[model samples]
Target: MQHRFEDKIIDTVIYTALLVLSLVSLYPFWNALVISLNSGADTSLGGVTVWPRAFTLDNYQVVLSDPRFFRALFMTVLRTVCGTAASIFFTALLAYGLSRKGTMGRKYYMLAAIFTMYFQGGLIPTYLWLRELGLFNNFWVLFVPWIISVWNMIVFRTFFQGLPEGLEESAKIDGCSFRIVLPLSGPVIATLSLFQAVLFWNEWFASGIYINDESLLPVQNYLMNMINSNSAQEMISQLSGVSGGVGDMVTRTITPKSLQMTALMVVSFPIMLVYPFVQKFFVKGVMVGSLKE
Candidate 1:
């Protein structure tokens, strides 16, 4: 009876803690949605919580209507897809080469690569190098610097090493190239690709620094610039000034913050949608790739 009562108390405490943590984790996203749906003018009045006081779609309308938004969205999507694919291919290729026991100087090459994980040429030198290479202001700059991630390479190598030795020998005997192993690495590839995609999708700092052309900037960079500058406010103010037809409702409902929140949701929603599809692969990959026999 005593042990049962103690276990119940412990379980209650853990459940309570988990509930609080979940709420804390989820509230910000919920609040952003609420603020986005609420009338901007009403949102500005403050104290709006749990639900939108004046529900409106004007925030999304403002975001979707902008030409720049579409351009940024296109750039973001392109970068994520292309970057993720290129990164995984290169990283896995390097991992495959290094995983072979017969490869000469593999240890030295791995040591050098791992060295880069802990040290780097600082920002100024990297910028100068990119500039000299003519990658500055170029779209390739987004993914080129990150094409072969050392950490991801390590994971791939481990996963590759864990494959049955006879499998590779049999494939080779059948006149197959080492590249044949890639078809068997689907889980790790899917997992790492998803990770790389999310990283590219959320990345804004590199784009802000390396990409001077606004058209090349991704959605995150666009959102960052809008939030940091007065552009969102200025655009909303300009829209508000047009006092006829839908303009009056726009003026009454939409504000810079609301638009910002809506854009935030827009930037996050696609990546959020991707997780469900690859989740099983992600879990399996992480478990298998992270462990070695």
Candidate 2:
């Protein structure tokens, strides 16, 4: 009875500790969300916590009403979709070719690819190269520079190697080419696609250098410039870029912090949604190649 009491106490203590840690980790996001959902003016007045003091959609209305915001959102979607698709397609194709042990000059091909991971022309040289290629200030500039991801290739290679050796033999005996065989690597492909999608979605630094067109800006870039502008009026102007319909409601209910938090939530919301859908594959991939094996 003494030992039973001691174990129960220990378990309770451990669970309590974990719960506190979880709350500590989550509180900032909770606070931000509360502030976002609350009346912006009330949020600025302070003391907002886990729940909104006064619930309103004016902050989101300000966000959704902007034409520029929609354009940036569209471009962000394009970058995530197109970049993720192209990266996986090309990286997997190259990885498939390299994974075949029977291929000629495979070592040289792998060496060439690996070399790129460690070395690149410095920023000036890259900028000059883009200029020469006439890619600067263009929407295609976003797509051109992200054609392949070396790290993802290495991961794909590792995952491909971990696939059953007998599967290769079976495919060979069945006389199936890459078209048939590659589709069977769904687990790793889905995992890699998720990885590259997040990368493309979060990427904005490339735009800071290569792109100047307002029309071509992705959400990250647009949000970043507004955040860094460090002026409340400038940020408000961004809110206005969305829609004039929300102008009166936003002016009455919104504040700068509310808009900023909303932008962050907007940036994060899509990826958060995407992860849950692919989470099973993500966990399975990690268990198979990345973490355990």
Candidate 3:
């Protein structure tokens, strides 16, 4: 009876600790949501806390109405789709080739991949190379530079290596080629493909560095310019007509904390929606692929 009571106490403590940690991790997202929904007046007055003190959808309405917002969102979606597809196709092909133990010149390919991970021609040289290739200011610039990630390739290769040798041998006896073997490697492919999708979706640095044209801006770059541009402040002042001060004007224009939170929510919503569906495959991939046989 005493031992049973002690075990119950331990379980209770563990559950309570986990509950606390979950709440702590989730607090910021909850706070951001609350702030985004609160009225600008209430937000400026610091009325929002854990819950919104005054409800308003005006912030989202304003953000969505802006043409730049839609343009950036569209470009980001395009980049994510194209980049992820290209990454999965090339990474799968390379990884499968590398998984074969005695494939000729495999060492050189492996060395080339590893060398890329450790060192690169710095940004300027890469930019100059891109310029020389005439890929500058092109939409292909987003997908081409990141067709394969070395780390992703390694992960995929290890996963391929871990597949049962019997499967390949059976396929070979049936006169099946490497192409046939590839279609059969679906789970690992899905896992790597999802990883590539997440990387492409979250990326902003490439867009920021390579894309200067307003039409080419990804969501991150668009949001960055919105946050930095002086004209944004003037527009905010005209809309709200709240002459709180220059400090207030700057706050309203450059980084309306509420609007920034809304932008973050917008940018992250698609990924968050996607992650739940792919999460099981992601975990499975990492667990099965992490260990080398």
Candidates' C-alpha lDDT: 0.89, 0.80, 0.77
Candidate 3: regions farther than 4 A off: 1-19, 173-175, 231-234, 237-255
TM-score of each candidate structure, all chains considered together = 0.95, 0.85, 0.85
Models ranked on TM-score? 1, 2, 3
Model 3, position 239, has a per-residue lDDT of 54
Across residues 19-56, which tens digit of lDDT does each residue of candidate 2 receive?
99999999998887888789988887878887999999
Q: Candidate 1: misplaced stretches above 4 Å?
A: 1-8, 177-179, 241-244
Predicted structure 2: lDDT: 0.80
Once fitted onto the true fold, the runs of candidate 2 whose alpha carbons sit more than 4 angstroms away are: 1-21, 173-175, 230-248, 290-293
Which is the better candidate, 2 or 3, if ranked by lDDT?
A: 2
lDDT of 1 at 251: 72
Model 3 lDDT tens row, 19-110: 99999999999989988788656677765779888776666766776778898889888988898888888987888899899789998999
- Backbone clash numbers for all candidates listed: 0, 6, 0
